[model samples]
Target: MSVLAAIAITTGILSGVWGWVAVSLGLLSWAGFLGCTSYFASPKDGLKGLGLSIATNLSGVFWAMVIIHLSTWVGIDIVGYVVTAVVAFFMCIQAKHNILNYIPGTFIGSCATFAAAGDWQLVVPSLLLGGVFGFAMKASGVWLQETLNKPDTELCEEN
Candidate 1:
């Protein structure tokens, strides 16, 4: 997780230097905030975290786009908040299904999408990169735990 965060921070700084401020912010959000969410949700399982992260990020982008479009025809502020709530509700429902728990990802995705102003070109790639890096970090953590021959029961209890 530390290594993943370091990479994310470095990437954000580099992105800002390159004048991609929106992308930088999105990456920072993913690395710092969303990553924590994934960690807490899945613990030592990187693959599950990766899947959830990707799904949530993409869901956010989709919802952002929808809200943006709807705002043009309605009250922007109202639409924004309402749409967010709706997405959250649906995501929670999905989370209730054991194999389909992806609410966290949706939250991250929505944040990233809004940060990037629903720009597909920007949001899509950034989310993908963040998701992949996050996954790799979690996987590495899992590997380290296994290499140390740590008991799974102990790890679960710590979480």
Candidate 2:
């Protein structure tokens, strides 16, 4: 149920942002359902996950858009795809707690927007970046988990 809701909301945000009239509302509705479920399930963690997902994904899109808008200056012809791949990879990496499971569709959806805007060069780079991002995030996740699992009073109690 929550998974389905998350999918819908993610789709809606991407579609709506790209002005896809048919899918916008539907996606938004799903997102709303996810929000409601998150609110009830584990308020702090759920909300934190939602916020992080939005920030990371949206920021990726924004950066991609900028890359597309100034492709020539960056010496990169495939700005859209490159950005998408990088963002996708990072999304997978930053999944934090299985959150990355929601990445594929969201990535394709956002990449579609950039492609529609006439930036095809970004495709390959986006894919490569996505892989790299995933690996990096996994490392970070492990570190975070280990760090968080330590007893808080151990150091504080000594010296």
Candidate 3:
């Protein structure tokens, strides 16, 4: 299959899955989609992309939770800005490491957590599930291409 075709089909199926998880489980599919996009938009592609997506996204969630917890304890709303800035600096500098190299992915995850109003309960599982969905989308497409486009000689040998 062509790249676009595979992407289109995978997207269609996964969107349905995401939708079901959202409405039935009362989770945030949009947040999950953000995580799914993290996979595609990582600095690297393929399995490495998936790994970076998971790593950076989870890191973002962890940092966001820390900021939330600390800001509440400090009892100062403005302090969130300072805390976020410091965390952002770390997020950027951490890109020097290969696994956490995707700064934008971290930002996306962090923003999603904030948008969900500090509800790590909702954001964490949703984002993780989305990453799994993203991997499934790519792997299934590759499987389809390999299974359907095999040579006639290969098919005959299998039979």
The whole-model lDDT of each prediction reads: 0.59, 0.42, 0.84
TM-scores for all predictions: 0.58, 0.30, 0.87
lDDT measured at residue 18 in model 3 versus the true structure, 0 to 100 = 86
Leading candidate by TM-score: 3
Segments in model 3 whose C-alpha atoms lie over 4 Å from true places: 75-78
Higher-ranked by lDDT: 1 or 2: 1
- Give the least accurate 10-residue stretch of model 3, judged by summed lDDT: 1-10
Q: On residues 1-159, what C-alpha lDDT tens digit does candidate 3 reach at each position?
A: 775687779778988988898778878899999988888777776788888998999888878888888888888889978887888899789889888889988888888898999888899888888887887787787777777789999999999
Scanning candidate 1 in windows of ten residues, the lowest lDDT window is 13-22
Per-residue lDDT of model 2, residues 9-69, tens digit only:
4444543443342243322323322222322232223345444434433444555565556
Kindly report the root-mean-square deviation of model 3 from the true structure over all alpha carbons.
Answer: 2.0
Highest-scoring model, lDDT: 3
lDDT of 3 at 141: 78
Number of clashing residue pairs, candidate 1 = 5
Ranking by TM-score: 3, 1, 2
